[model samples]
Target: MEKRIVTVQYNYDVAIVGSGVAGLFGACHMDPSLKVLVIAKREPDLTNTSLAQGGIAAVLDTVNDNQEDHIRDTMIAGGYENNPDAVRLLVSRGPADVRELMELGAVFDRNPDGSLNYTLEGGHCRPRIVHHKDSTGSEVQRALLAYVRTLPNVTIWEDSLVALLKKDTCFHLDVIQEHTDLIRHVNARVCLLATGGIGRVYEYTTNSKIATGDGIAFAYRLGARIKNLHYIQFHPTGFANKKDRETFLISESVRGEGGYLLNAEKKRFMQNYDPRQELAPRDVVSHFEMVETKRQNSNDLWLDISYKPADFIRQRFP
Candidate 1:
């Protein structure tokens, strides 16, 4: 028989699982009086959020872009299958969120005149992506983590995995510390699962190792109806490095910023499938890649941006 070490159960007003952008951001907005507990399955910084390279898209400039345009673009990208009300709300409220991120000390790239330097990405008609060079998500996470740490009412525990969850009058959680294998019980009036995507389940993916769908699994067990499991979209461009299971993602912004996609023959083939070519939505581009691969009988593809000036490339990507 094994001797189990169990700690006393602690209570919190809100228990947020996973330290990705969603978790950290939610923690930042919690009322200071409410005791908040954030649990991370690994080091807080190592999350899918940190792996995001492309900038967030929002209609920050109303002069050239508007919320309706943003909503339309999103709907088109989603193949018109998205909820209209949700898209409207997101597009309408997104600029304020971006402004709030800036208020929280997340610095994005700016123009020489001091306005936000917005860039373009695949599936968008406007240049509305505000980023910190190319690592927008990391910058956002860093700012949120820093702000969350300053809140005395909030606590962050890394390397703590939520093994089991039960709900009664309140929510109960069984947490296992990865380092010491110590078990601890936690109770929270509210439980928010911010666990990210289910990418690691695939043979090859660009998603972070922590994206194992833990939150989705927990939600399903809690009687939440799961749908659209088959809606997984493959990225059109990833570095074909056979060495690692996780291929490096070539950001869609690359194509948005004039990068070209070439097939095995070192010639562009996207024109044959879609007029938008490289700028097509991810699913469309990914589908055509497969079709072109079969036609060419080779998986050799290239994303070329070397034609741009060295200084411009460095300024945009770095």
Candidate 2:
């Protein structure tokens, strides 16, 4: 018989499963003295964060937009059923976090005068979205990953799958190293689960492969109370690719920057539905699209922005 004992070499101060935006950002806030390990089930780039294209909605321009307005918009979008305290916290702290990302080399567009250019998204009273072209999520991920790499206290393991988690005095994670099929027992004083969305549950969704809601499932198994699991949201405009089961997202930022949505008749019809027109929030747009598509008896719709200047569209959306 072979005797086996789990070694102490796998210990860490903190263990983060999933390398999405939340995981990476949370790791950035930890003390440099603490030993931290970030585990990605696949390559670090394979995350829902990279698939986000619509950009962060932060009250960056305080003169034109206030925290209260942003909070109100969010509440309205949620039909006033949102947690007021949580919404307030997110609205207050989000801008500073986004600004921190800028300092860490995340870039966004600037006007000719060189001030941060803001765009109006649906449900927003003012232009408050800051983005790096159409690839805002990718830009933020690139910057944060690079900054995390520079931290001496953090270790990143890619292609590492966290199979199971159990709680003792501290948390023990069963991590499987891919390709080699070797298993290691890693212990952490604190554990954070940042696994992204659960879009794979649907056949048509604009979610990445890594978004299987594994974190939520793990937490539920550990007796954590799960709320709002029923409140799943959908993106309005995903690229109509029949060959790809996973639809590519057409960012709402395009509509924010003045893209128009047309019905099968080739006539712009969003204004007839909502006064905000193309600038309506995602839930509103998506819900109405379903209703109207059935009413009109067609699955086809067209989105055109040709009326806007070509130079402007290329520069803003590119």
Candidate 3:
């Protein structure tokens, strides 16, 4: 097949901001003949997707899992306040989306018999997480980026920040490229924002430094409707040390794979808070840990996976 040509014409069929999962996936789904411009505040690999430790949630093996269970679990975790339509859409499409990732060279961990390995996470009724050891995010990002690079219709502009978006016949973006300090006004027939998360606002977070709420802020400035700004999902285990204070994340899979939350007294305290205990949803576990920390007047807590056989931890986590 002859490769399609991408010209830096006066405009593009679509302009996507933030080359994370959202942007990359959007580009991947568009017509190969359509010109697509992907703008990122930094390199595509530096986005929040690259920092994720957990895997994508999907019911690939329906023999053991179902979308209804996933939806119910998500709603319960969201305090029964999640958008039903959105949750339904996600649950319905998640399996196919994850399958697309696999086709694009995302190497998920597989069982010895060559079937997909699905691990359990908090709020999940069955083992449904598709991951690449502890570096699932990096693996997915790499696979997506690799595929995106081969698409002749796609162009990636790194270190370019979208300063403004204006509605017209098409969307207009006032972009500032960091290295050259050059500013340009570009218009596209369609615009998609895939910028992820707002963790920089907090004093402590497990998010990457680039998760600075820029996308949400930009959307708000453009008069777009925003939802769930107040709800921040804090992971239960972060490598809580002064040196690597906010950078390292102890994957939730550790807890899912038989780790226990221990207080200063070395007691399994999560059971006292929720029946699911360590397997409770992230918000529940985080809030419970906070309550325990306040009660004991101590900031430090421990997540003990020591009970698991050493080789299993090394093989799965290391």
Each candidate's number of clashing pairs is 0, 1, 0
> Model 1, 186-272: lDDT tens per residue?
999999999999988999998888888999999999899998888998878888889888888878889989999999999998999
RMSD of each: 1.2, 2.6, 5.5
Backbone clashes in candidate 2 total 1
lDDT of 2 at 98: 86
Better of 1 and 3 by lDDT: 1
Give candidate 1 regions above 4 Å deviation: 1-3
Q: List the residue pairs that clash in candidate 2.
A: 122-279
Highest-scoring model, TM-score? 1
Please, what is the whole-model Cα lDDT of each candidate in the order they appear? 0.90, 0.87, 0.87
Clashing pairs in 1: none
Model 2 lDDT per residue over 59-177, tens place: 98888889999999999988898999999999999999989999989998888899988887888988898888888999989999999999999999999888889887999998878
**Minimal lDDT window, size 10, model 3:** 1-10
Give me the candidate number with maximum lDDT. Answer: 1
Candidate 1, after superposition: displacement of residue 42 in Å?
0.8
